[model samples]
Structures are given as structure tokens and as C-alpha cells.
Target: MPATFIRRIASPKKAVTGLAVAAATAGMALTAAPAHAATTSSAADAKAIAKQMIPDSAQYNAFSKIVQHESGWDVDATNPSSGAYGLVQALPGSKMASAGSDWKTNAKTQIEWGLNYMNDRYGSPAGAWDFWQANGWY
Candidate 1:
């Protein structure tokens, strides 16, 4: 018989381990995407809820103006010096607990609390805007 030589091939376990790592990394990436999407969608949902609650178009516009200046409609915004937080930047932030337990993470809760604050403090969003325009803070 002619000389025969057999070379060992790479280990199958190593190939499987590499594929497992790749699959785990891809799964983690997918998880990250949902969290990002949820944050964006929550902002949209909060804005929609705010619009729906503010039956008057002028009031909604006024509310939008205030929110734009305060936190740019970001529910997670926080003022480092004052500890104010959320879309309306409620000082102490804990005051939003009255709206809901999810106030820290839920934009809708923040919007609801913000609207109530505007209505209670300034009599209405337009009133708040007027104050904000004149004083730079509402």
C-alpha cells in the first residue's frame, strides 16, 4: 500500500463555542435595541397623551412651549443643581410620586403630573407660559 498520512482537523467543540459566543452577542444586541425603542416610543406616547388631555389647542401649544424650554420634552431630564426632573422639571422630583409610582420611568406619568402642576400653580398652561416668558422660569 502507498504511504498514508492523516492530519488532525480542528476541534468541533471549538467551532461550537465560537458560534455560541456569536449567538449570545447577537442576542444581547437585540435586547439593547428594544430598550432604545421603548424610550423613544414612551416619549411619543407621553406627548400624545398630553395632547389628548389638553382639550384646548391653545393650551396644548402653550404646554409644549414650556416643556420645550424646561426639559425639551425629555422625561428623564434632571437639573443637577435643583434636583428637578422629568418633562416639566419638578423640583425635588419626588413630588411626582403622587401621579404614579412609575413617574421616574414613565413619560405619561410625568406629563400628567406636569399638567396638574401647571393648572394648579399658574391656573393654566398658557398662564404658565406667560410667566415663563417674562421670568425665564415657571
Candidate 2:
């Protein structure tokens, strides 16, 4: 052979290291980005939307109080023993699925499910709260 030239490529270890560095940099950027707030509405908003379902002001207040006591207005709240989850803490947790897919993370769905539950089971928020007070459930 008149002339021969050989060039060694970077090893697998070096390629892996390069990939790791790139991945880490991407992860850091993602973490540094501001978190997006969960799409949600307040209990007041929920009440306003469903006001026709709960016409009585006193009943609305009681229901609002009970939910506040249970979750402090957190739609993601969960009770371990009862598997009650979301604003209204539907037993089995999956009951809110009827409203929408975001039941676990969306406040509007939780509120809608809660309002429906109260109307169907207890006739009103106050009625549901009354049962909750007496039995620690509704």
C-alpha cells in the first residue's frame, strides 16, 4: 500500500457521556422554566355556575364551609381511608370521571361532580353538609 490513514472514532462511553450531558442540560432548562398553573376555577365560580341547583344562600354557605373544612378548597385533596378525592371527595374517587378526564387535576370537573352529587343525593349543599356533620360523610 502506498499510503494508509486511520482515524479512531470516539468510544461508546464518550458517546453516552455526551448524550447524558445534553439530556441533563435539557432537564435543567425544563426545571428552570416557570411551572404552569393548573387550569381551575374557584368554589365561588363553581357556585355561580351551578347557582340554580342551590338557590338557597344558607345551604350554599354550609356546603361551601364543609368543602373548605375538608379540603381548604384544594381540588386535588384526597382522603386515604375513604378513597375520597377532589373538592367533594367522591368515594372511590372515580365518580368525578363522569364530569371530565381532569377530575384529579381540574377544579371545574371536581366542582361539577360535587354539585351533581349534592343535588342527586341530598337535594342541596346544606343537606349534604348536614349529613356530613352528623356522620363525617355525605
Candidate 3:
């Protein structure tokens, strides 16, 4: 007979606490707004904006896939677990403010920020999509 080894995982509370400690140590405060907070547009409107912003069909599709998985095109989407917010799920949602002041309620601003992030980090939306597909994130 073969014996199996068991692995243990940290509880969600412990994991979140550890993350909060790390963030605090780095001088960053983690915060998230309620998902229902002021939303200026619907998913359909955001999708339309994304299509216009990303004119290339292939690139747009790739970007769309990532957004669908991350926030389902919600302009004010918030990840209760990680505090990621907006259409791109920017870890500190405030990061999107670099794109525009309307980051919180504007789909266009979020998309712009997301596009820049994809371009800067992975070369293109398609590249980001490839990474997201392999890692379940981007």
C-alpha cells in the first residue's frame, strides 16, 4: 500500500491578513468600494466603447475575452476578494486615475487605462490574452 501526503492551505482570513500586512508594510492602503456604488454605464455600453477603442477585430476579441473573464464589462466592477476594480480589474483601481479622473464611473477611462497596461506589460492585447489564458489572469 502507498501512503499519500496531505497538504494544508492557509484560511482566507489568514491569507487576507497576510496580504494586508504586506501592503501596510509597503505604505499602501488597500480599499474597495461597494460593487453597487455609482455606475455610469451598462455592460453593453462598455462593450460598445471597447469595440470602438480597439478597432482591430482580433485584438478587440482578445481584449474582450479578458474583460469578460475579469469584470464582465462592468464599468464599476469590484472584486470583493482582492479589491480589484473597474473594467480591467486594476489592483488598486486608483491606478486607473492616471488615465482619467473619471476612472471610477467611466468605462472609457477604464478601457484606456487597461489598453495602456496591456500594451506596456505584454506588448498587445493579444499577448495579454495569451498570458491570461495560461495563468487565468493578466
Candidate 4:
């Protein structure tokens, strides 16, 4: 099997990244309510976006763990070595173009691609979570 396919199939991190890409393709818009007129995103902000992309309640906890481990919820998180970027860490960061051109900084695109990947390969978040448990990298 191809490494990319295996990577997409096994990794929760990759699954979340796939969800972001799907969100971008679907043109998911994120709105912020200001606590004091300065728009800010909290953990809830990430969770809200995540819930929209991933509707399965069982998948939520597993997905959140991967996001926290990979990027700590920072939308602009980047890996210099592989050039992965965004909340879910898109490798080369540009493969997200499969979803949209805004893949670089748009959290939606990354999440979309990730969710699509998880659904396609493992069938559900629980399946992805099981794979993750067996493989540390996932």
C-alpha cells in the first residue's frame, strides 16, 4: 500500500487535517462573537468548528486529542521540517488545494480534508481512534 494512503488511513492527525480541507471546500464560515469587541477564539471556538465538520459524538474526543497533540489548537501551527501547517498540520500544506486555495491558513480546509480521510479509510472516528491507539504516530 502507498505510504500516503496508509498515512491517511491510520493517523487521527491526518484525519483532522482532512476535515479542515472539506470545510474549506464547502465554504464553511466561522463567526466570532466578541467578549469585549475584540474577536477571539477559545477552546470552544475550535470545538465548534470541529463539531460542524465531525458530527459523530464518539469521534469528538479522539479528534480533539490528535489536534491538541499535533498543534495545540493553534491555527497557524507549522512544522518546518515537512512544511506542514495549519490547525491539523497539512503536509506541504498545499495538498489542501484539493479542497480550496485557502488551505494554508484556513482551519476549515484542514478539518474537511481530515474528516473525509477518516470517513473514507476507517469508516468512523472510533475506527480511527483504534488505529491511533495501535500506532503512536496515528
Candidate 2 local lDDT, 25-122, one digit each (tens): 65732234655447655665555544554567887687777778877676767887777887777887797889887777777677778888887989
Backbone clashes in each candidate structure, one number apiece? 0, 0, 0, 23
Ranking by lDDT: 3, 1, 2, 4
| lDDT (C-alpha) at residue 97 in model 2 | 88
Cα lDDT for residue 132, model 2? 86
Ranking by TM-score: 3, 1, 4, 2
- lDDT string for model 4 (1-138, tens) is 225443344688677676666656668744555433222145567668888877777787777777777678776688878777766676766766787666655566667776666667788656766787788544
TM-scores for all candidates: the values are 0.68, 0.60, 0.71, 0.61
Q: What does the lDDT read for residue 77 in candidate 3?
A: 84
lDDT of each: 0.81, 0.71, 0.88, 0.67
Please estimate how well model 2 matches the true structure, expressed as its whole-model Cα lDDT.
0.71
RMSD from true fold, candidate 1: 10.2
Q: Write the per-residue lDDT of candidate 3 for residues 28-127, one digit (tens) a residue.
A: 8989755543445689889888999999999999999999999988877899999999899999999999998779898888999999999999999999
lDDT of 4 at 120: 77
Off by over 4 Å in 4: 1-43
